[model samples]
Target: MVLLPFSARNTSETNDWNGSKLKDDSKHYKLLVVGGGAGGLGAASKFARKLPRGSVGIIEPHEDHYYQPGFTLVGGGLMTLRETTRKQEKLIPSGAKWIRNEVVLFTPTQNMVTLDGGEDISYDYMVVAMGAHLRFDKIKGALEALETPGVCSNYSPFHVEKHYREVMNFQGGNAIYTYPNGPIKCAGAPQKACYITDSILRQRGVRENAHMIYATSLDKIFGVENYVKPLEEVAQEKDIDVRTRRNLIEIDTSKNSATFQLLDENGAATEDTEKIEYSLLHIGPPCSAPKALRKSPFADKTGFMDVDDGTLQSKKFPNVFGVGDCMNTPNAKTAASVSSHLKTLDRNLTFAMLGKKPYFKYDGYASCPLVVSKNRVILAEFNSKGPLETTPLNQGKPAYWAFLLKKYFMPALYWNGLIRGYWNGPATIRKFSRLVDSKKRQGVL
Candidate 1:
């Protein structure tokens, strides 16, 4: 493939594209990646190294990239917002061409995408990794409430920093945290914020005065049953009132109250409504795939990229695949899931390019290091079947080492390993740990 030099024309259509010249109205690549988040960057990095230079292209709109898992730490006062961010340009692979724009239209049937700057991008194969969007506006007063003093959300970078402040400033009253009624990245994050706040309040001698409540749409404390028992125990020990089937529908900033709609076991909303006055409110906002994918032909009814659950390939378009939270998969939307799913995506996409049927299947693998306190975390690892723990220790119990890993090691792994295509989840590590365990049992030196 021949790489064209960027033109110097200052056309209106290419003005927002960072002044990068378009050789023509359309450009083609061997492989194209949408979004520069964990999944996109990882897959692009893998193919960029495999394909010829300039054959791989990535379309991303943002200037900054974030280590999103660190947001929980930031809200817990364990990490700063700046520590979780980096320049998006620096993270792109050397062999990949970066298209600094967002996709306005996705035409998978034509193997083409139209950018916001009106440039057409076509590729032999495409990977959609646009990730999910936090729809805070879904709740009636969420946006306005986020600007207020006591209302904050770890899901939003703008308001994440305020969570620590809100926890510290709380004198006494109801400290309410909410979980929305849809798929969200890091399903464990909502309670992480609450647990951190409980730790901080107890340290400040305010735990006795505050009534801590966790309101979630789910019927259980956690999806994975192996981890739920311990988490419920932790909640009970921390004196947190865990209310299931309660979803935050609105926030009243003027009255310092939050309204929750009660749901039945089937997740259907009932007419009963409960309003609780709060000293501080932390919301895990509802999330959805990007509007471009939602409106596209390859979208599922839930507005996510329509792909086969096990193959991660578009059902209708064989050349199109999905990675990360944007895809309609049964797994929890976490960066760890991206790391594992990308392994399946990378192999399957490569096979598709070579006109071979993909043999590898994604097991819906996902991990969540549930931070239950300041220095304790329950590392929950599982797949569609059940608990797929990496270590020999019981992962359902809170451990200090897991806390340290979540707080420190995971961030470094994300920046240096995952997005660079060097990490392929914990399968290798899990295998190694099992080998060691067997050796130990046999008394092997």
Candidate 2:
């Protein structure tokens, strides 16, 4: 593999090996991956190791890679912001060609993608992994409100550290946290910050004075009912007020007031508006797929890459596939979900390349380690059907052991196993544990 010298030409211009202009026609690759996030990197790593050298080309704009799940811990002070990031060059597989560019257009019809620089890259097969976009500016008063002392959010790398500072500075008052009205990565994260803040306040002997409140646009605490009951119990035990059907509308930083529109059970906005004074605010903003992909012909009506739920291939374009947060798969967006996606995508894409049908189907497995407190967690593992537990022990119950797995083992598995294309989540482990549990019951009889 050779490292091409950095050409200073504009993105639209064609270049030769000697830095001069090339002929109209250009080179292509077997696989082209857009985005360098978890899904893109995961797919690139698998293809680079399995396919011949120079077979894969990755178009990613960022020079750094982030382990985004750790951002919650960073906000909780369990990990530093520095720990969540690494150089993108280190993560991109050695054999793959890296184009430090963003995809400006997706031309599925032509089997090509145009980069921001105006250069066109053609591929025999393409994988779209450009993850979701966080739009904080869409919310009214969000930008102005966030500049105030009490306002903070953990959604972006730029704003994550402010969460801890805001929580710590809170003397005593309504400490509100929120979940936006759309699909968000790590659904448990908004509440995780609240839980961590509650624990922190208790440690500082201020828990009694602080009124912890959670305002979410969703009607339920969690999507899965199995975890919802136990999580509600945890909130009750912590004296946190959980309000559903409340959407954050505006913020008045000068007056230190947060405004919310109350919605009925049917999701219609009611006439009444609620205002609360807050000492601290943690926000989870709305997210969507990158604009380029969302507007492209490849996207579904919901603005995500329309892929087969089972095989991870585009429903309209067989040669195009997606993995990670960008795909319209019915799984919670988490690193755990990405682990499962990569496994199914690897096998199915390989089969597709061989002109054969995909044998394996993804079950929508996604896991969220609900950090209920500083030392305990409830490992919520589920698939499209419902919760899929791996441990023989009951998972709905909070356990210290589960916390340890989340804090230590899970990070290692993500960096080494998932990123290396070796991990496929805990599905096999879940199956094996079920078998062991069955045998144990028989023996007890």
**Number of the predicted model whose lDDT against the real structure is largest:** 1
Model 1, residue 134: C-alpha shift (Å): 0.3
Residue pairs in steric clash, candidate 1? none
How many clashing residue pairs appear in each of the predictions shown?
A: 0, 1
lDDT by residue (tens digit), candidate 2, 333-359: 888999889888888877776667876
Native-referenced Cα lDDT, model 1: 0.89
Residues forming the 10-long window of minimal summed lDDT in candidate 2? 1-10
Q: In candidate 2, which residue ranges exceed 4 Å CA deviation?
A: 1-27
User: What TM-score, over all chains together, does every model reach?
Assistant: 0.93, 0.92
CA RMSD (A), model 1: 5.4
TM-score of 2: 0.92
